[model samples]
Target chain A: MSSPKAKVLLVGMGGVGSVAAYSLEYGGKAEVTAVLRSDYQTLIDDGFEFESVDHGKVNCFRPTNITKSVEEAMEKYGPFDYAIFSLKNIPDISPIEPLIAKCYTPEVGILLLQNGIGIEKPIFKLFPEAYVMSGVTMVSSTLYGRKVVHVATEHVRVGAYDNGKIPYEKQVAKCKKFIEIYSTDKNDIIYDENVNFSRWRKLVYNACVNSSAALTDCDIGRLEVFGAMDPIVRPAMREILAIAKSDGVDLPEDVIEFMIRSDDGEWYPPSMLVDMRKGNYCEYQVILGNALDIAKENGVPAPVLSCMYHLLHVVQMKTQEKKGKFVLPEVRPLPADNFQIKYLN
Target chain B: MSSPKAKVLLVGMGGVGSVAAYSLEYGGKAEVTAVLRSDYQTLIDDGFEFESVDHGKVNCFRPTNITKSVEEAMEKYGPFDYAIFSLKNIPDISPIEPLIAKCYTPEVGILLLQNGIGIEKPIFKLFPEAYVMSGVTMVSSTLYGRKVVHVATEHVRVGAYDNGKIPYEKQVAKCKKFIEIYSTDKNDIIYDENVNFSRWRKLVYNACVNSSAALTDCDIGRLEVFGAMDPIVRPAMREILAIAKSDGVDLPEDVIEFMIRSDDGEWYPPSMLVDMRKGNYCEYQVILGNALDIAKENGVPAPVLSCMYHLLHVVQMKTQEKKGKFVLPEVRPLPADNFQIKYLN
Candidate 1:
């Protein structure tokens, strides 16, 4: 009997997602459907105007199928082989359950292509019986206007989340096939056995570079110009490494050094900084706050990381307030004398 | 001779300097000659268009003398009784030695009415024989246009910077007279024995409120709205207090809490943020960097303060870059793919 054709439902066609969707379609391996909101009409009507070093220009990227909502996507093309979710991991903005419940099935494996750790936990909780996995990418992509996505890097790593019951071979097979479907001549995709470690490793970079850029209004290479590495990024990275160690993940000793040296010549405004520029809330809580909580749970002191986390939190909330989603509490201006100057007149 | 009317040459008549100049003239206790730079033409031509809560509106403040340069001030009115300096403490902008060298003498006292720590060190080094005193104020004053200074608070604390050889009573006496000369019925001026401790105490506030506002682009009261008190301000204050304690100052334990709670109602943007808005360099190094260095010197950990310090440093450098004074080091953007991602075919 011929094998059933694999069907994929991808949500959130942002910078990262658009690239992934393009890569998936380029391989001509799976029936790809995209679920997009906000830009759904534009993308559906005009398709994505894509630019990348790998692919000179993809003027139009209309997926095989597109829908605004998950319910519609499922209604039109349901019981998919894989459901891919790619959105920012910021909190208090949107709910994820309805989308997951409508698209997810016992046989449908969920793949989260997002930055940060613990993003898949709530998904796993909602659908404990469903197959769930996560992927991390080092690709630099930004969605400009509503239709164009600029891409610079094109490397991705995917692995099935530790469901405790899923065997290694079975998980590897699932992830390998997913990687094959997404990998293109222009894009390189890999399947990693140690996905948790890979996520943690990426967190080390995100927790520092993303927060620093957003907070400083600086691009990555400007960090060196400002000498932020020794005082800001490196210290935060060390704290993050310690937090990882406390989580029983022993990252390499030179990981911090490697991270710094790697960025010695490059300049990229991380997605979080891009979000800040767009007046959108950042994934500070997921990327930084989660690491801090884990550090606290493991009795590790992450003062540097904690500092950046708090600063970034303020920045994010301020951004939200600017966007009119968050309203700041107004208070009376304090009487000047109440600030307390010791008087000995 | 009525003490030769106590000739005083006040330089850099910005907000703090303007208020001090007005106070000295209002007291009718000294011959206040202001050696203004940019505002000198304005003062010499139209005089200071002043406004204050303490004194409703002093239409014009034509000091006994106003000159454009230290050389001009010294050549015009030299060997003053007190060389009062009130300038923002930013580095690489201007030099203070020439001013001190020109205006100061053996009998002249140096009273620096500024918002920072370690500002008086170089002055002391240059004029070891000059009686140097430092003062801290809770006054909120800003220079509007080129002539007007609006003041909100009017309390000033002056203490003689301990010169080691100067007796406590002698230092206090000098500071007391300086305060008396600058004190008006509209302004409350007091002499303190522990000026260094007082500077550290003020640093606690500036290092927290000023840098927080400057970095977050939020006012002091807005910190509470963003919950920056618990996470950002209080932690930084605690670290600053620790540094003070390490320096044998022993600031009050409730200082941090008091600073936070005191700001519960008010929402004034600190001067550093104001400086940022003006596209001027902030006093970050003097306010936060000195505190951090002292903490490091005393072997005390100041992670929170260090975070703010680094953030403020970047902000200050960015401000300088904005003003076209400080040029950032240029580097070529990294070739994108060099991040080294392994591919599985």
Candidate 2:
């Protein structure tokens, strides 16, 4: 079924990355060079263990090459057809340009299977001529160290990201080529004509559920049990809709009901909450920050979205403080001895 | 200073309660019957130790009498001229009616030196004919167990709480009588003709700074350090102002700037934040919940305030869960073994 093996480098091989590498490689469509920053050596020794409903229990599914850095991946597997990013989108900690520039080639296109709106803009600004493919995934995969548990249903919406300068047909051709390699018979892959619409749609769920759980220190299931999803999460979803409307995307109002009901019973913690649990920085920038900037730009009165952005900013900043990346000033309690009433002018 | 000493029953001997008890008694115009709940025995053995700038260190400033329960205080010191409330206004866990009903007398006019708008309503509703006096204070006091530290400058504005049924002049006379007994030569106290004005002004600070700190798990100092005061806190203050306007009150626009500037350099954690650190339920109901209700009632779009309310609700609920009041459902990880793609209708 393969015309020729397309060489793709996947950066940040965590939950989604491992599953994607598994899906692409298992389909015999592409050979992936994985960039495992923390678990490179462990992955090289044990490889990825998958317990999937689709592929069944598979042991030690190794990539074509496992490199610890993007530069390392490029040196070994240079001039690749494409490089996919399944990493977190935290621009304050790590920017996208320097990393993407190392993997850049005129012929090679870029694929981002990351979350959040306006993520493509940075890369698009960096490499104006480079074809960028965006992927919106609904895959339930968890990579706990070297082991992956793919919990059944997987569907992805892939589309070409418009830079406005590039021809539409040329962009579609490159995007289609990515789908060809990434898609499996079992995978429900849809080619989205308008990727931004799909992104804003995904945000309706992520912005609502993820922010509610993390900010409240409650999981999604508990949030539902507390009868808070409507009062807290629904209003946030509505704000996102208002912001998206300003972007000329009319996300169907029923999508809010659909998302809330879909997550009604499931007790799974989303990515941002898990990020906080691990003491790792959350992807608040991608999830809430970028959309909020648009809301500000278009004069959309997005109160809930703005609050999430600011609150999540502090949350991320705190994680930064924990990591020694940011130093928080000590808030001294009112000094008991210095209670002098020096009247001011 | 030859006036007969007024009899007062002070409930909830926390930070503010102890200070108010001290101020009213130290003035030599009021004799307070203090309700020391948990620390009743500790305080009985070794009475309050005060380190104050205004009054100096007044050792063993025991009230006229100290009782553990409100019922005990009622029995020990009945027919009190006034019963002052300085505890948190969390209506969810503890409502106003039951507690105040025990302390109520035909002559005992209720005085609330607590934070929040619309708090006087419940007590007024219960004791419709009972004259309710409201007090707004800018006194920074901290009581760590038996130790009381008065951190200098204290200013209070006292006024009559109108229940619509009560005549304005009758209410003012009751309010003035209470203030006359509570005020000292050292204290900066004012008689407020309109108490709601002062309450809303205080809300300008409380609603913004308090919620921002608690929800973000950050102190006010850190929020300022992160350059978040202008972006996060200011917007929330503006929202409060708009909500205030709907109540037929016009808080000056500079009040936003003034509130932000006042909290600019201070690193002290606000009450809500302190409540969170102690794992005690925050006073979010009084600070954010009631204001959010007002915002909703008037159709004022308060994104930031609403976000804080919902988020704090979750935070409080999580604490409730920690205390075994709420049972958080298990958010099970996606089961890899049984990942069936059962197509739905």
Candidate 3:
């Protein structure tokens, strides 16, 4: 019956991730499996809930299977047709492979429903024959234990990463097939001819508003209303655009205005701000580090990004220390006999 | 015989202000009168204490006079030779005149024993006939109630802000006269021929290290031992230098290194950080805002400084809100009846 409905697996289910899983199951063309590691017990006991404008108060996400880990999911339902990664693309924290290796199969289309650039390269390098696709999403939402409250619009633009191992025509065909299953009238999924264009353009928002909101306690809405948008947001967007141009991507000039004027002046607490508030590790490596590396390679100066990067790095380090994942260096012992009290002595 | 021991009145008695008062009295050239508004009762009851290496656990500074306000002090001890404005030079918080007008007679030297560039402009604008001298100090100390725990070195550089209304020779004499009264062997006070040069050089440290440590929760010791010095500190220093060069002030390169490796890896919680922690208004206006204005006027692109300035402004705004000093704007309302849910519809 329709080739077993194209079995799919989903991991890293945050607010955005949960939306993807819910949307896929709602489309009714795939059997969805979600791996709930941190909140597996809470999720199973309470189930998933969403107060979405699209789905109108969805009480639960009925994925075909739920497991603690991907290996467990693979053992229950192996060789899935598509495995979607919805986690933050921080490879240092969560490695791509070993987690998805057991469920790996040739011709399995890999979709990255996450933020940041250069996420597809790692997957393609690991699973050479698998068709790699990258998806950029803008959903104003936050995730808690087994629940998501999406406030504004949820739009996704996805495109294939051009795996030369698979023929171009075949890759395009498979991309369209995934879209058929993933898209609903509400989900509003579209195919980007050049996803890099979509990505660098998104960076205009991510690298500027997201980072500023995270660093300062100001949200996007407050920042826009207040006087910070011109000083912090616009200049940072210009820097991102410069870096993107260096990498051969020309984002529009009004992309800045488009990013700022969100639907209905909603106070969007960006994902990084939420993550920092929750003491969870943020997504700086993909969002800023990758772009900074590109800037460095091309000899473009991104002072604003560099400043935010270093500050955010310190924040991440502090977060890691709080989690007992990393230890901060000891404060060097002060010299005793040097006697620096000029007036005191 | 000693010409009535110069009557010098001091307002804004925090740790640095207290130290300046104590040193001026200790030097025995002037009878120091201190204005203590918030801590007047405590200071009068408990007096002042300094656990100093130079003075050796000094208890109670013997200023010639101490009062609750400048008017009170002027009423009791009028027509003072010098009125040192050691408070944060924040005129917005505390207006200059009326507070000092009663005590202000011609030839009363106004020494700004505070941080910032272009602080003298306002002073000259208001009181053109008075000699305006700026003193930049680096003191490791903190004030609590009426007590001060002096930790490390305290060095001050004093120079005249060239009042063309007065003869150059007369201004130089007034500067040296105040320095004589303000310096003990321990005070380590030096006179800078070009105070703007000193102010710009000092900004090389203030604009970078102090602001960064305040923005991030790191101290100078930790920032040095950690890896933030290169990313946040040096680049900001370079920009400040570039702006200074644009305005015809050339600061040396080694100032960055010298500012970081303080006496024996000592932990210096910058004043702004301490101020933020204490829920007090910070000095971004003088420290960053003024410098950024200069950068803009000179057409020098100080992206790092501008970025820090904006973020710090937001932080200052939040601080103001917490203190009930400023009211933030309300979040804009969303649309009432726009039905745009594509997938669900």
Candidate 4:
């Protein structure tokens, strides 16, 4: 018998989600369905365009199962074998709780292609019977007008949440099939023993490099070349590592080096920096909020990251106030007196 | 005899020197001898123009004692009672060493209005017989064409070198008279017990505030509002404090607060930022070089400051190559281990 075609549903078709959907469809290993906030009529009338750095423009007219609401998505693409959750970390998880309850099944798996550490536990609590897998994408993508532009092509790694203890064989299989669809290289998928370390590794990269790049308003490539990177980047990374260690996550020194050196000496602009450039809200909460929360719980010192988060939160708050929408990410308060400021007066 | 007229020679007819010269003349404190390099012939021919942010423009001609060389300056304005050294920290000390040796008499007190710390020590070594004093000017002056514009009415603090062992009472009196001639308020000159602390304070400010601002290419006023300031600025301040402590300079905690909480609470752009904006070679050595040296001597880790210095040095080196001047600032090498890239994979 022929291998079964995996059914994948992508919620929130932003830059990342759009790219993942296109990748899944282009690779032809899965039947991809994209659920977007915009009306299906608009996207149907004007087909989606995909542009990538590695691959040229590929436009085709296929039945792009698009819907505005999750309910409509569930009705149209119900019992999805795998759901790719790549939404912004805003509006909380309350709105999605009911949807997850309705669509979640014992056999179906959920893969989170979002930033931040420990987003799976809350969802797991909401749907204890369903399997949840965590993953991080190094691919850099952005939405330029209606077209999705992939700036950087990196690999994707997904693993069973919490070390795959609760019968995640089907979920693992689904994730592997989805990875094959999304990635040009099949070896990119790494089913980790504990996905928390992988999540923390990516989080550390974003917390230090992304936050600094956003704050400085410089491209990542130029920022690394500039002198400000070390003083700004290292302390923030160290703080994130401290918080992770306290939370029982052991991040290897080599992992930190890999994250820093992974840029291939080329300046890759992080999502936060790109958002800041566009005058939009960033996922500061995903990167910094998690670290700050862990720092508070573990009682680790994180003065530099705390200050950065505070300033970024203030900026995000101002941006949200102007936008009149809760599209911006949330930031957690940092522990008090984690670090002291010394003056020469 | 008319208090010997207090003959004063000012080297470098830059914006700051021109303003100081004007202040000294208007204050009737001394006989102001303004010396300029070959490029400032226009200012000598066409009278000096002074403009204030609060007040309007005022024009005056003092027939500046312009000279092509320092030897000529000494010949024309010899046996000077005070010499204001306010040149860019380039061309090394070799150019000025002989001139100071020849012209620096026991009565001639050298006032260093340059950025950074430990500059006076080199001068002290070069001219042991002459007295050296260090001072910091909070005044903001810039040159627009032939006009010297004062953006803020900030005060200056002057102190004798080595805890006032050199009988600076006469020199202070001379400075007071010069301030009056330059139309500066009498309250601007501050004499303290230890001027070295003030120098250290300024160094800390430069290392943290200036270097970051330059690297980010943001104005001080804008940097305060920029989200990156906290991450980029605070650690730089901490690293500088660490280096200072290692160098045996005790900076009070309050000074750091004061630096952050300026009277205006707006970002205060350092001269380094201005230099970066203008695409001029910065005085990186005078600012970060000294701190790096002290940090090395004290065996303290100063990765941030060292990185900033190195980046600035590279920029300077590149500029020098383009200009074919070979005028790069001297910086102390950083600790090998501390200088290694931790995050850059």
Candidate 5:
């Protein structure tokens, strides 16, 4: 007898989350429910729109199940088999905890579909008894307003979160089941045993492209202009590779080469650049800053990574300043310490 | 014959150029001529205005000599004793060559009151027989419209272009003479024998504060927040120190320490940030890129400096794109070689 169909609740419907939802529903495999915080009304009222090369057009995609918050999702769908998180990791923000809390169940497995290093740590720490799987998606997507998403390419790698207490068989079983339900003609989901390796690999591309694109305001193609790949891109990747090696995560030998050559002249702006253009806070903290922290802990001198992290922070702060959230400190005059007023007053 | 008072022609009447002109005129020394490129008409018609803490407000005080271009200035003033260049260093622009070409004379010395390394090379190369000197100023000033410059604090270090062929006596003589005429109560000019040392010293501040301010769009005070000093600023400085050491130029050990601690909560925006805000190209090439090149040539690892240089390049490319001069390469489609020759025939 076949096992029951997996029930999935996806959070944060930016680009990746929405793509996952559409792929699952289009494939007609899983009972996919999505929790959208910001544009719940828009999706409910207008439905989700997706323009895909693989699957012609999806207009007003009212998902099988959708709600505003995780609490609402839990109320409507009961307990989910897997809770997939695809939210951005903005620094100084704490919305993730409540979402995880509302979705917690002893049997429900967790899957983190976010971009960053060691994102699963907090989740694993919070739910030590829970089965937590980690994922890295190499899906090129763009969001137009509240409902529209343009999926350029889609591929996903899933594995167990590193340093978790879960056994390998359980982790692989969960990942394999999720992939079986998640894969569509448009999206390819892989069950990888080495989740840490996958995270580190995706990180190389993220650290180099996302920060450079946002900073340069150039897409992948324009970034390679005037031999930037030779001087700036490769050197930065080399530095990140060293940091990754120091952390005992040996990525492929030609990872940097693969990352650079994989551009294929596509002028797709990375998500961070899109965030920067829209004056929104980017996911730099998790993407680059977290890796920088690890490098520091490992005593690896990752100067280029450190520079990229801070430069991205500068871009983030500039956006924050524009939003009126970051105000410059006021200048004050010094005191007249040695002045005598006498009778002149 | 007391060397017939130095006839000086100042180029690029931005803040620095205007400040030098005012200080010279206020000191009642030299026949100070200025080349006002953008605001020649306004300066000639309404005269120069200065609002200064050191030299109180001076309204509509016309100079003895002012012209639109180097040709006009040379035509009006006949081969001045010194041609002071207080212009910015923008890559892929050629304003300097024309200025030098029009104002060429053997007797006249060249005082490059500009920030950046190896800037004196082209000038020295052009006029092999001319006496060339380099000057780095610590003058706090800003330009208001076409005429006014508010001089806040002023100190100048004048030295010979280190790698030039001019004799030491000649270099010192020119610097001393220029300082004698250029000093006001608002400005102090000093003659330093080691110009390379001074350049490297000033570079510490430039590579750190200037690049940070421009990249983050934050003034000095705000940059200190969020521990940027520990992560970004100091690491960049350390890389620059390595570059400087490879070039055999020993900057003071306390230069970085001195620079960071000296920012006593003043919200001063560096020049590069001002230019960046105005959508103008900055001096990253001379300030950071040149150092990176030197580091590469010397085989000294300067990852932080390299990242800073490229990130600054990205910002510059954004500005260029805004100016309508930079268009991204078009995305080409794949070949249609396998199509049928006859369609519906």
Candidate 6:
């Protein structure tokens, strides 16, 4: 029997979302419906550019079904088989809830592609009737103008939310088919028994790596090479693990090790670091805020994480206050005079 | 009557020491003697090279009066007018204490040219007879092989230690005559009542700018353009100021402003950052360690400084350990396959 056609709706045509849409389209598993904040006329006239680290360039001319508003998207392509939500956690989720409630279909599964742990539960609560799943993508992609560049090919782990029973067999099949196009391991699609554990595992990885990288302004691989595994990663991991246990999610040691000892360990500059570097205040509330909430809820003390959260918060606040007012400070210019040194001196 | 020709012994033939020696020699104010760790043979074979930042190259050869031992230096150039010391702080000062005791002459003065604050008192305790003074050099110079390359035409600040009451007027006058050759009036050569305060001021500047630059792995000029100044410099300045105040050193507000405001008010990378890029652990102990010590001693709370110290220490220690063993862990290399978009995508 021929497989049925699947309709996929990708929200927020940012780096990861756009790449995943291309992966789905190129994999020939589904028809992608992209919801972007940019003008539809511009997208139609200019089109989107696709570039990757592995596969140099793959430009598509196919007329993309794009919309700026969820209402417009629902009106054009309703009842999507999968709604891939990769929106940033800023501006809070309240603004997006009404739209999700209006657009979500019973058959559609919401796949959350974001950093940090526990953002999916609130989304799930908003759409209790909808199939909710959480995904952790290790791939690195960035949006450049109208182009989406896939910088690195890493893994993506998707599982049921709250370890709820894997959606119907058909849903599982559709999810796997969608993931297979972009991810190397077709079998890496794990139906994790505890999605929170998986999420926490990823969070632990991010909490240790991202904050340190952002604060130190070093790359991820450089951080580990500098022995972050001991003083930084381990200390952070212990606190996250404590928080996870209080939430009744148990992260495996092997999993933590796997996160730290990845084959190609380099500075994986997190999106937050990118934002900070660009002078944009990231959604620290979503990433670190959730961690802090868990810590408070579980009565676990996360000293390092707490410190990082405060630092990021202060950074965000200061950046906001000084936005548009930032002018480069005048510094002493490099000496114009050049001196040649002969060994005899 | 005219002062007797000032006889100068410079310990540590690194960049700063060599440049200072060159300045003294070029000014024709004092007779110079360099006591390097390397033997006299190497000094004679490869004469010290001086590359000026403003002026072109100048090669001058003094007699090969170098030695591997401090005792030897004392025997050859001791009971002299002044002894200038600038050495690394690692391996502690114990190794140099005996050397200092043997070489220190009551008639001779000692001027320390090391970075950071608070190294004079211990030396004073070690050699009560000799006049101990402190100086801060602003000139940027680096040693390439046996040659010293001066990168900037900056000034130097010299002052007497502990209120200029060392009871060695002849020696102080001799030292002043030697420094007058290079330092312009733009940078004061005044003897402050508390040289430690001057040292503390310079230390505060270094701790804020240098550590952040080193940690971020960027040049000083990049910090402002990169928006790193707000996140890295602001908090570090607050902490350093707190520590300085607690140590009974009241740093002027204008000095702090001078540090934050770019020379013309533009971004500039300090030398420590340059050292980090070169993979050298330069001045961390002097910058961060001194602040840490002051904080601990004076009961000042410096969370930001503490965090930076810990982070820098880890990087330095790990780098050192890796160097000692010569076994580096495999890290993820930069993604050569991908292109980063410089602007918004």
Q: CA lDDT of each candidate?
A: 0.78, 0.82, 0.78, 0.66, 0.75, 0.66
DockQ of each: 0.41, 0.35, 0.40, 0.10, 0.31, 0.17
Error of 4 at B345 (Å): 33
| Top candidate when judged by TM-score against the true structure | 1
Model 5 Cα shift for residue A45 (angstroms): 1.4
Question: Tens digits of per-residue lDDT for model 3 on A1-345?
Answer: 455577889987878888888888887788888887887876777788898877878787657788898888888887788889887776656667666576788878888887887777776667777787788887666676667888656688888889788788888787888888889878788887698899999888888888888887777766665567777888888889899999899987888878877534567687788787777888888898888989999999888888888888777665655677644335444534343212211
Docking class of 3: acceptable
Give the poorly placed runs of model 3, Cα more than 4 Å off. Answer: A1-3, A60-62, A95-102, A333-345, B1-3, B59-64, B91-102, B333-345
Alpha-carbon shift of residue B79 in model 3 (angstroms):
2.3
Global Cα RMSD, each model: 6.5, 6.4, 6.4, 8.3, 6.8, 11.2
**Residue-wise lDDT of candidate 5 within B1-345, one digit each (tens)?**
455566888887777777787777778777788887778888888877778666778787656788888888898887888889888767454448678878878777788888877677777667776678888887777777854666556777888664356566776777787777887766678887777677888788888888988877777665665346777788778777778888888876788988775656467677888898888889998899888878889999876677778878877766766676645436622123321112121
lDDT of 3 by residue, B124-182 (tens): 66678878888888765667766787776678888988879889889999999888777
Please, what are the lDDT tens digits per residue for candidate 5 over residues A1-345?
Answer: 765667889988877888877887777777788888778888888887778655657777877888888898999996998898888877344447668889999778788888888777777667776778888888776657664555556788888664456676776787787788888776778888888888888888888888878777777766765335666777678777877888788977698878875766566677778887787888888888888888889887766667777877766666665667645436611122322212211
Best candidate (score: lDDT): 2
Q: What is the per-residue lDDT of model 6 for residues B49-116, given as tens digits with 9 covering 90 to 100?
A: 66777444867455336666678777776666777776654422123466567677766667877787
Please tell me the interface RMSD, in Å, for model 3: 6.8
lDDT of 2 at B48: 85
Q: State the lDDT at A302 in candidate 2.
A: 72
lDDT of 6 by residue, A1-345 (tens): 768657877787777776676666655667778887753555677777778775568675232477777778788887777787877766431345666786787667778877777777776667665666678877677877777788777356786554244436655565565555435322234554456666787787677667776765556666665555676667777788888888888777666677665535454676666877887667767667788898998788876676566555545544644564344324434324221211211
* Candidate 5 CAPRI-style tier: acceptable
Tens-digit lDDT track of model 1 for A1-345: 655557999998888888888778777787788998788889867888888766778888888899988999899999798999887666545656667899877778789888777777777677765677789888777788665555566898888886666675676677788887788788878887777799999887889988888887887776756668888898889888898888878899788777766655556677777777877788888899888989889899988788888877777667766767644435544544343212222
What is the iRMS for every candidate structure? 6.9, 7.4, 6.8, 11.6, 8.5, 11.4
Higher-DockQ candidate of 2 and 3: 3
TM-score of each candidate's B chain against the true B chain? 0.90, 0.92, 0.90, 0.82, 0.89, 0.79
Q: Write model 4 residue lDDT over B1-345, tens digit each, in one string.
A: 545466778777676676677667656556776667744677767876878653357785453466666677788778787888766665332245665676677777777777777777777666554566576877778877777788776366776665244556765565554444334453266665577777788776777777766765554544554455466566678777777777667888767756765524333567787877676777788788778888888888765666556556645544443455532122322323243222211
Clashing pairs in 2: none
